[model samples]
Target: MAFEGIWNVVMPMGRSRELVRFSKTDLLSSLQIPSERHLLVAGLETKNDYFEGIPWIVIQHNLDVIRNITISTGPRTESVTKAVDLYLEQIKVRGNKTLSDY
Candidate 1:
């Protein structure tokens, strides 16, 4: 048998969750990180006894990437522009990086 890896992000919603699957572009665009080199790191992958020792590589990678993004909006935003502005502001505060930072 061949080892076929599947990557995804499972979001917690109350007692349930949603599955999000994406490619490299999705991860990059979501984080607003222009460079893959900025996100990828050495020895970032992990292996567990999870499901018979298959490594949870994708989960680890997603966790790291998602940490740098605001995937959800706050309650008071009430508008797309405000939510977007907030995300942009967050990125600005974290570092002087934006859509044009590349």
Candidate 2:
């Protein structure tokens, strides 16, 4: 399957963890980087497996080209949710602050 589309994912690389926004093309490009050999070396079709292998928790917001959603696979569910929650909280705070400025 062609992994092409906008996806919201939490990718944990080593000790560092952060939410990543990726278009399928962007993901393919990342796989080209030498540092990301682990993902490319195996020629993995299921890219999410490298993160945490299992059925990922997917929340679909809309049926459009840009699927702005959160995805987490396997035992790392908690971490993914936490990261997404934090991101949402930040957006909420920023929205509130913007309203206050008005």
Q: Which candidate is the best by lDDT?
A: 1
lDDT string, candidate 1, 1-102, tens digits: 001132344445555565545465676576554433323321121222222111333544434543454423333223323433444454334233332321
lDDT of 1 at 85: 43
lDDT of 2 by residue, 4-102 (tens): 232445565555665555554465455432112222212221124443211232212111101222333433435344433443343343322221121
How big is the positional error of residue 73 in model 2, measured in Å on the Cα after superposition? 11
Error of 1 at 22 (Å): 4.5
Q: By summed lDDT, which 10 consecutive residues of candidate 2 come out lowest? A: 57-66
- The estimated TM-scores of all candidates read 0.23, 0.23
* Residue 10, candidate 1: alpha-carbon lDDT: 47
Regions more than 4 Å wrong, model 1: 1-14, 41-102
